[model samples]
Target: MPPIRTFTAALGLAAMTATLLVSAAEAAPRNRYVQVQGADGRGYVASRNAHRTSSSFTANRSIQTNGGYGLNRNRSAAYGEGSYSGSSQTVFNSGRSINRSASVHDNGDGTASYQRTVTGSEGRSRSVSGSVPYTPPQ
Candidate 1:
Protein backbone atom coordinates (compact mmCIF):
# COMPACT_ATOMS: atom_id res chain seq x y z
CA MET A 1 0.00 0.00 0.00
CA PRO A 2 1.07 3.60 -0.41
CA PRO A 3 2.43 5.53 2.65
CA ILE A 4 -0.63 7.81 2.90
CA ARG A 5 -3.02 4.86 2.61
CA THR A 6 -1.16 2.89 5.29
CA PHE A 7 -1.31 5.85 7.79
CA THR A 8 -5.00 6.47 7.10
CA ALA A 9 -5.83 2.75 7.60
CA ALA A 10 -4.05 2.70 10.99
CA LEU A 11 -5.82 5.86 12.13
CA GLY A 12 -9.22 4.38 11.15
CA LEU A 13 -8.52 1.13 13.01
CA ALA A 14 -7.49 3.07 16.19
CA ALA A 15 -10.65 5.16 16.07
CA MET A 16 -12.81 1.96 15.73
CA THR A 17 -11.01 0.27 18.71
CA ALA A 18 -11.52 3.42 20.90
CA THR A 19 -15.24 3.51 20.01
CA LEU A 20 -15.71 -0.24 20.78
CA LEU A 21 -14.11 0.23 24.28
CA VAL A 22 -16.25 3.26 25.08
CA SER A 23 -19.47 1.47 24.04
CA ALA A 24 -18.56 -1.70 25.99
CA ALA A 25 -18.04 0.37 29.17
CA GLU A 26 -21.28 2.27 28.65
CA ALA A 27 -23.27 -0.97 28.04
CA ALA A 28 -22.05 -2.71 31.22
CA PRO A 29 -24.72 -3.28 33.89
CA ARG A 30 -24.98 -1.52 37.30
CA ASN A 31 -26.77 -2.58 40.52
CA ARG A 32 -28.58 -0.55 43.15
CA TYR A 33 -29.75 -1.22 46.79
CA VAL A 34 -32.72 0.26 48.63
CA GLN A 35 -32.54 2.00 52.02
CA VAL A 36 -35.19 1.15 54.64
CA GLN A 37 -36.59 3.54 57.24
CA GLY A 38 -37.27 2.86 60.97
CA ALA A 39 -39.53 -0.16 61.78
CA ASP A 40 -40.10 -2.96 64.36
CA GLY A 41 -41.29 -6.60 64.35
CA ARG A 42 -41.58 -9.06 61.42
CA GLY A 43 -43.93 -11.48 59.51
CA TYR A 44 -47.78 -12.08 59.83
CA VAL A 45 -50.57 -14.65 59.33
CA ALA A 46 -54.06 -14.60 57.69
CA SER A 47 -56.89 -16.93 56.59
CA ARG A 48 -60.66 -17.17 55.73
CA ASN A 49 -63.37 -19.83 55.50
CA ALA A 50 -67.00 -20.40 54.35
CA HIS A 51 -69.53 -23.24 54.66
CA ARG A 52 -73.15 -24.33 53.81
CA THR A 53 -75.33 -27.17 55.14
CA SER A 54 -78.87 -28.70 54.92
CA SER A 55 -80.97 -31.38 56.61
CA SER A 56 -83.51 -34.08 55.53
CA PHE A 57 -86.97 -35.23 56.76
CA THR A 58 -88.24 -38.31 58.57
CA ALA A 59 -91.60 -39.93 59.73
CA ASN A 60 -92.71 -42.66 62.16
CA ARG A 61 -95.96 -44.57 62.84
CA SER A 62 -96.22 -46.32 66.24
CA ILE A 63 -98.30 -46.50 69.45
CA GLN A 64 -97.12 -47.00 73.04
CA THR A 65 -99.16 -47.28 76.25
CA ASN A 66 -96.34 -45.74 78.29
CA GLY A 67 -95.11 -42.60 76.44
CA GLY A 68 -93.55 -41.38 73.20
CA TYR A 69 -91.53 -38.27 72.28
CA GLY A 70 -89.60 -37.11 69.24
CA LEU A 71 -87.34 -34.11 68.81
CA ASN A 72 -85.58 -32.72 65.72
CA ARG A 73 -82.99 -30.01 66.17
CA ASN A 74 -81.24 -28.00 63.44
CA ARG A 75 -78.64 -25.47 64.46
CA SER A 76 -75.78 -23.80 62.58
CA ALA A 77 -73.17 -21.37 63.78
CA ALA A 78 -70.09 -19.78 62.21
CA TYR A 79 -67.31 -17.97 64.05
CA GLY A 80 -64.17 -16.18 62.92
CA GLU A 81 -61.15 -14.77 64.70
CA GLY A 82 -58.84 -12.00 63.51
CA SER A 83 -55.49 -11.25 65.06
CA TYR A 84 -53.34 -8.45 63.61
CA SER A 85 -50.09 -8.68 65.48
CA GLY A 86 -46.36 -9.11 64.90
CA SER A 87 -46.11 -11.34 67.97
CA SER A 88 -46.24 -15.16 67.81
CA GLN A 89 -49.07 -17.12 69.46
CA THR A 90 -50.09 -20.77 70.01
CA VAL A 91 -53.72 -22.00 70.29
CA PHE A 92 -55.58 -25.24 71.05
CA ASN A 93 -59.24 -26.46 71.46
CA SER A 94 -61.11 -29.67 72.53
CA GLY A 95 -64.69 -30.99 73.18
CA ARG A 96 -66.91 -34.10 73.95
CA SER A 97 -70.61 -35.25 74.03
CA ILE A 98 -73.10 -36.90 76.42
CA ASN A 99 -76.88 -36.99 75.72
CA ARG A 100 -79.72 -38.34 77.86
CA SER A 101 -83.49 -37.88 77.79
CA ALA A 102 -85.96 -39.67 80.13
CA SER A 103 -88.69 -38.73 82.74
CA VAL A 104 -86.74 -35.50 83.23
CA HIS A 105 -86.54 -33.72 86.58
CA ASP A 106 -84.54 -30.48 86.98
CA ASN A 107 -83.32 -29.12 90.31
CA GLY A 108 -81.57 -25.84 90.94
CA ASP A 109 -79.82 -24.14 93.89
CA GLY A 110 -80.78 -20.56 94.80
CA THR A 111 -77.39 -19.09 93.74
CA ALA A 112 -76.61 -21.52 90.88
CA SER A 113 -75.84 -20.65 87.25
CA TYR A 114 -76.03 -23.01 84.27
CA GLN A 115 -74.22 -23.07 80.92
CA ARG A 116 -74.65 -25.24 77.77
CA THR A 117 -72.47 -25.82 74.69
CA VAL A 118 -72.36 -28.23 71.72
CA THR A 119 -69.43 -29.66 69.72
CA GLY A 120 -69.12 -31.17 66.25
CA SER A 121 -68.06 -34.82 65.70
CA GLU A 122 -67.05 -36.88 68.80
CA GLY A 123 -64.61 -34.33 70.13
CA ARG A 124 -64.16 -33.32 73.78
CA SER A 125 -64.78 -29.90 75.35
CA ARG A 126 -62.40 -28.08 77.66
CA SER A 127 -62.49 -24.66 79.31
CA VAL A 128 -60.50 -22.69 81.84
CA SER A 129 -61.55 -19.74 83.99
CA GLY A 130 -60.02 -17.70 86.78
CA SER A 131 -61.97 -16.04 89.62
CA VAL A 132 -61.18 -14.01 92.73
CA PRO A 133 -63.77 -12.98 95.34
CA TYR A 134 -63.42 -10.16 97.82
CA THR A 135 -63.25 -10.88 101.59
CA PRO A 136 -64.98 -8.61 104.07
CA PRO A 137 -62.84 -7.20 106.96
CA GLN A 138 -63.96 -7.94 110.51
Candidate 2:
Protein backbone atom coordinates (compact mmCIF):
# COMPACT_ATOMS: atom_id res chain seq x y z
CA MET A 1 0.00 0.00 0.00
CA PRO A 2 2.86 2.43 0.75
CA PRO A 3 4.45 1.69 -2.65
CA ILE A 4 1.14 2.40 -4.41
CA ARG A 5 0.88 5.73 -2.59
CA THR A 6 4.44 6.71 -3.61
CA PHE A 7 3.80 5.81 -7.24
CA THR A 8 0.66 7.93 -7.33
CA ALA A 9 2.52 10.89 -5.85
CA ALA A 10 5.31 10.55 -8.46
CA LEU A 11 2.79 10.38 -11.36
CA GLY A 12 1.02 13.53 -10.19
CA LEU A 13 4.32 15.41 -9.89
CA ALA A 14 5.31 14.44 -13.44
CA ALA A 15 1.97 15.60 -14.89
CA MET A 16 2.25 18.99 -13.17
CA THR A 17 5.81 19.46 -14.44
CA ALA A 18 4.72 18.70 -18.02
CA THR A 19 1.88 21.17 -17.84
CA LEU A 20 4.14 23.96 -16.53
CA LEU A 21 6.66 23.38 -19.29
CA VAL A 22 4.02 23.56 -22.04
CA SER A 23 2.50 26.73 -20.64
CA ALA A 24 5.87 28.40 -20.30
CA ALA A 25 6.68 27.62 -23.92
CA GLU A 26 3.36 29.05 -25.08
CA ALA A 27 3.90 32.27 -23.09
CA ALA A 28 7.18 33.03 -24.86
CA PRO A 29 6.96 35.71 -27.57
CA ARG A 30 8.19 35.08 -31.12
CA ASN A 31 10.41 37.34 -33.29
CA ARG A 32 8.65 38.73 -36.38
CA TYR A 33 9.76 40.27 -39.75
CA VAL A 34 8.52 41.35 -43.19
CA GLN A 35 9.67 41.51 -46.84
CA VAL A 36 8.71 43.39 -50.01
CA GLN A 37 8.79 42.75 -53.77
CA GLY A 38 11.13 44.52 -56.21
CA ALA A 39 10.28 46.62 -59.27
CA ASP A 40 10.44 43.46 -61.39
CA GLY A 41 7.67 41.98 -59.23
CA ARG A 42 10.00 39.33 -57.77
CA GLY A 43 10.92 38.45 -54.21
CA TYR A 44 14.13 39.89 -52.74
CA VAL A 45 16.86 38.26 -50.63
CA ALA A 46 16.10 37.84 -46.93
CA SER A 47 16.60 41.26 -45.26
CA ARG A 48 14.88 43.98 -43.17
CA ASN A 49 14.87 47.49 -44.65
CA ALA A 50 12.79 50.71 -44.64
CA HIS A 51 12.10 52.58 -47.91
CA ARG A 52 11.27 56.29 -48.56
CA THR A 53 10.92 58.97 -51.26
CA SER A 54 10.21 62.74 -51.54
CA SER A 55 9.70 65.50 -54.14
CA SER A 56 8.81 69.19 -54.04
CA PHE A 57 8.55 72.36 -56.13
CA THR A 58 8.10 76.12 -55.72
CA ALA A 59 7.18 78.99 -58.10
CA ASN A 60 6.92 82.77 -57.74
CA ARG A 61 5.92 85.66 -60.00
CA SER A 62 6.27 89.43 -59.62
CA ILE A 63 5.12 92.13 -62.05
CA GLN A 64 4.50 95.89 -62.23
CA THR A 65 1.40 97.37 -63.98
CA ASN A 66 0.35 100.95 -64.83
CA GLY A 67 -3.25 101.78 -63.85
CA GLY A 68 -5.66 103.86 -65.92
CA TYR A 69 -5.24 106.68 -63.36
CA GLY A 70 -1.48 106.94 -64.12
CA LEU A 71 -0.68 105.15 -60.86
CA ASN A 72 2.02 102.40 -60.70
CA ARG A 73 1.12 99.20 -58.86
CA ASN A 74 3.22 96.12 -58.02
CA ARG A 75 1.70 92.62 -57.94
CA SER A 76 3.28 89.51 -56.46
CA ALA A 77 2.13 85.93 -56.27
CA ALA A 78 3.79 82.80 -54.93
CA TYR A 79 2.76 79.11 -55.10
CA GLY A 80 4.23 75.91 -53.74
CA GLU A 81 3.44 72.22 -53.86
CA GLY A 82 5.01 69.01 -52.60
CA SER A 83 4.50 65.24 -52.80
CA TYR A 84 6.06 61.99 -51.64
CA SER A 85 5.77 58.23 -52.20
CA GLY A 86 7.60 55.26 -50.74
CA SER A 87 7.49 51.84 -49.04
CA SER A 88 9.39 49.62 -46.63
CA GLN A 89 10.03 45.90 -46.22
CA THR A 90 11.56 43.86 -43.43
CA VAL A 91 12.60 40.24 -43.98
CA PHE A 92 14.20 37.43 -42.05
CA ASN A 93 15.87 34.22 -43.12
CA SER A 94 12.75 32.47 -41.93
CA GLY A 95 10.06 34.76 -43.45
CA ARG A 96 9.18 38.19 -45.01
CA SER A 97 7.66 41.66 -44.23
CA ILE A 98 6.56 44.93 -45.89
CA ASN A 99 5.30 48.55 -45.21
CA ARG A 100 4.48 51.55 -47.43
CA SER A 101 3.52 55.30 -47.23
CA ALA A 102 2.69 58.25 -49.53
CA SER A 103 1.66 61.92 -49.15
CA VAL A 104 0.75 65.05 -51.19
CA HIS A 105 0.25 68.74 -50.33
CA ASP A 106 -0.93 71.73 -52.37
CA ASN A 107 -0.64 75.28 -51.09
CA GLY A 108 -1.99 78.78 -51.95
CA ASP A 109 -3.89 78.71 -55.25
CA GLY A 110 -3.00 75.25 -56.45
CA THR A 111 -5.43 72.38 -57.00
CA ALA A 112 -6.33 70.12 -54.07
CA SER A 113 -4.99 66.57 -54.12
CA TYR A 114 -4.16 63.65 -51.82
CA GLN A 115 -2.73 60.15 -52.15
CA ARG A 116 -2.31 57.08 -49.94
CA THR A 117 -0.66 53.79 -50.74
CA VAL A 118 0.48 50.58 -49.03
CA THR A 119 2.92 48.01 -50.38
CA GLY A 120 4.00 44.55 -49.19
CA SER A 121 6.62 41.90 -49.91
CA GLU A 122 7.89 38.36 -49.15
CA GLY A 123 11.30 36.83 -49.92
CA ARG A 124 14.84 35.69 -48.89
CA SER A 125 17.49 37.54 -46.72
CA ARG A 126 19.39 39.38 -49.46
CA SER A 127 16.67 41.91 -50.28
CA VAL A 128 16.81 44.41 -47.38
CA SER A 129 19.52 47.05 -47.15
CA GLY A 130 20.92 49.36 -44.45
CA SER A 131 21.20 52.53 -46.61
CA VAL A 132 20.45 54.17 -49.96
CA PRO A 133 17.50 52.14 -51.29
CA TYR A 134 16.05 51.98 -47.82
CA THR A 135 17.17 55.36 -46.46
CA PRO A 136 14.29 57.21 -44.74
CA PRO A 137 13.71 60.92 -45.45
CA GLN A 138 14.10 63.45 -42.66
Candidate 3:
Protein backbone atom coordinates (compact mmCIF):
# COMPACT_ATOMS: atom_id res chain seq x y z
CA MET A 1 0.00 0.00 0.00
CA PRO A 2 1.04 3.63 -0.42
CA PRO A 3 2.82 5.35 2.49
CA ILE A 4 -0.12 7.71 3.07
CA ARG A 5 -2.60 4.86 3.22
CA THR A 6 -0.38 2.88 5.58
CA PHE A 7 0.01 5.84 7.90
CA THR A 8 -3.74 6.42 7.96
CA ALA A 9 -4.40 2.80 8.77
CA ALA A 10 -1.89 2.85 11.61
CA LEU A 11 -3.43 5.99 13.05
CA GLY A 12 -6.90 4.50 12.92
CA LEU A 13 -5.74 1.34 14.62
CA ALA A 14 -4.04 3.34 17.36
CA ALA A 15 -7.16 5.36 17.99
CA MET A 16 -9.28 2.24 18.23
CA THR A 17 -6.83 0.60 20.59
CA ALA A 18 -6.72 3.65 22.86
CA THR A 19 -10.48 3.75 23.04
CA LEU A 20 -10.67 0.10 23.94
CA LEU A 21 -8.02 0.45 26.58
CA VAL A 22 -9.81 3.33 28.23
CA SER A 23 -13.11 1.51 28.15
CA ALA A 24 -11.65 -1.61 29.66
CA ALA A 25 -9.95 0.35 32.39
CA GLU A 26 -13.18 2.10 33.27
CA ALA A 27 -15.29 -1.03 33.18
CA ALA A 28 -13.39 -2.88 35.89
CA PRO A 29 -13.45 -1.95 39.55
CA ARG A 30 -10.36 -2.19 41.74
CA ASN A 31 -10.46 -4.25 44.87
CA ARG A 32 -8.02 -5.27 47.56
CA TYR A 33 -8.10 -7.51 50.64
CA VAL A 34 -5.52 -8.09 53.29
CA GLN A 35 -5.12 -10.05 56.52
CA VAL A 36 -2.43 -10.12 59.15
CA GLN A 37 -1.81 -12.37 62.10
CA GLY A 38 0.47 -11.92 65.08
CA ALA A 39 2.28 -14.58 67.01
CA ASP A 40 0.06 -13.83 70.01
CA GLY A 41 -3.00 -14.95 68.07
CA ARG A 42 -4.25 -11.47 67.30
CA GLY A 43 -5.18 -10.79 63.70
CA TYR A 44 -7.04 -8.33 61.54
CA VAL A 45 -8.66 -8.46 58.13
CA ALA A 46 -9.26 -5.53 55.81
CA SER A 47 -10.86 -5.14 52.43
CA ARG A 48 -11.59 -2.32 50.07
CA ASN A 49 -13.50 -2.05 46.83
CA ALA A 50 -13.58 1.01 44.62
CA HIS A 51 -14.97 1.96 41.25
CA ARG A 52 -14.29 5.16 39.41
CA THR A 53 -15.06 6.81 36.09
CA SER A 54 -14.26 10.15 34.60
CA SER A 55 -16.90 11.95 36.62
CA SER A 56 -17.94 9.71 39.48
CA PHE A 57 -16.68 7.22 42.00
CA THR A 58 -17.76 4.98 44.89
CA ALA A 59 -15.78 3.11 47.47
CA ASN A 60 -16.18 0.93 50.53
CA ARG A 61 -13.75 -0.33 53.12
CA SER A 62 -13.95 -2.55 56.17
CA ILE A 63 -11.63 -3.91 58.82
CA GLN A 64 -12.17 -6.36 61.63
CA THR A 65 -9.86 -7.26 64.47
CA ASN A 66 -9.81 -10.51 66.33
CA GLY A 67 -10.69 -8.68 69.53
CA GLY A 68 -14.24 -7.81 68.42
CA TYR A 69 -13.25 -4.38 67.16
CA GLY A 70 -14.39 -3.56 63.66
CA LEU A 71 -14.97 -0.59 61.43
CA ASN A 72 -16.77 -0.15 58.13
CA ARG A 73 -17.20 2.83 55.86
CA ASN A 74 -18.77 3.71 52.55
CA ARG A 75 -18.54 6.80 50.37
CA SER A 76 -19.59 7.97 46.92
CA ALA A 77 -19.53 11.13 44.86
CA ALA A 78 -20.42 12.49 41.44
CA TYR A 79 -19.87 15.71 39.55
CA GLY A 80 -21.62 16.94 36.42
CA GLU A 81 -23.52 19.88 35.03
CA GLY A 82 -21.90 22.23 37.53
CA SER A 83 -23.00 20.29 40.59
CA TYR A 84 -21.50 17.82 42.99
CA SER A 85 -22.68 15.68 45.88
CA GLY A 86 -21.22 13.13 48.22
CA SER A 87 -21.95 11.26 51.44
CA SER A 88 -20.27 8.84 53.79
CA GLN A 89 -20.93 6.79 56.88
CA THR A 90 -18.67 4.95 59.29
CA VAL A 91 -19.61 2.49 61.97
CA PHE A 92 -17.73 0.61 64.63
CA ASN A 93 -18.52 -2.58 66.46
CA SER A 94 -18.85 -0.65 69.69
CA GLY A 95 -22.19 0.80 68.67
CA ARG A 96 -20.62 4.11 67.82
CA SER A 97 -20.98 5.67 64.36
CA ILE A 98 -20.54 8.82 62.40
CA ASN A 99 -22.33 10.01 59.28
CA ARG A 100 -21.71 12.93 57.00
CA SER A 101 -23.03 14.30 53.72
CA ALA A 102 -22.46 17.33 51.58
CA SER A 103 -23.53 18.88 48.29
CA VAL A 104 -22.49 21.83 46.18
CA HIS A 105 -24.10 23.49 43.19
CA ASP A 106 -22.83 26.15 40.87
CA ASN A 107 -24.88 29.36 40.85
CA GLY A 108 -23.85 30.37 37.33
CA ASP A 109 -22.29 33.60 38.55
CA GLY A 110 -18.88 32.66 39.77
CA THR A 111 -20.36 31.36 43.01
CA ALA A 112 -21.50 28.07 44.39
CA SER A 113 -23.91 27.06 47.12
CA TYR A 114 -23.09 24.31 49.54
CA GLN A 115 -24.67 22.39 52.38
CA ARG A 116 -23.17 19.91 54.77
CA THR A 117 -24.30 17.85 57.71
CA VAL A 118 -22.61 15.63 60.27
CA THR A 119 -23.95 13.30 62.90
CA GLY A 120 -22.07 11.90 65.83
CA SER A 121 -22.27 8.58 67.60
CA GLU A 122 -24.87 9.88 69.98
CA GLY A 123 -27.18 10.77 67.08
CA ARG A 124 -26.57 14.48 67.49
CA SER A 125 -26.43 16.20 64.14
CA ARG A 126 -25.31 19.60 62.93
CA SER A 127 -25.50 21.31 59.57
CA VAL A 128 -24.02 24.32 57.85
CA SER A 129 -25.10 25.78 54.52
CA GLY A 130 -23.86 28.77 52.59
CA SER A 131 -22.62 30.13 49.29
CA VAL A 132 -19.17 31.23 48.32
CA PRO A 133 -17.38 32.62 45.33
CA TYR A 134 -15.38 29.93 43.57
CA THR A 135 -12.16 30.21 41.67
CA PRO A 136 -10.75 26.98 40.39
CA PRO A 137 -7.02 26.44 40.65
CA GLN A 138 -4.97 27.59 37.73
State which candidate has the highest lDDT: 3
Q: For candidate 3, report its TM-score.
A: 0.75
Clashes of each: 7, 14, 0
Task: Give the candidate number with the greatest TM-score.
Answer: 3
Best-first order by lDDT: 3, 2, 1
Report the lDDT tens digits of candidate 2 across residue range 10-66. 333333223323333343333324344556555432222221112221122222122
**TM-score per candidate, in order?**
0.17, 0.24, 0.75
Please provide, for model 1 over 79-125, each residue's C-alpha lDDT reduced to its tens digit, 9 standing for 90 to 100: 11110001111122222223211110111221111122323344454
Which pairs in model 3 have colliding backbones? none
The 10-residue segment with the lowest total lDDT in model 2 = 128-137
Q: Model 3: runs farther than 4 Å from truth?
A: 1-27, 136-138
Query: How would you encode candidate 3's per-residue C-alpha lDDT over 33-90 as one tens digit per residue?
Result: 9999998889999999998765676899999999989999999876656566778899
Candidate 3, 6: how far from true, in Å?
Answer: 56
| TM-score, structure 2 vs. true | 0.24
Off by over 4 Å in 2: 1-81, 107-112, 122-138
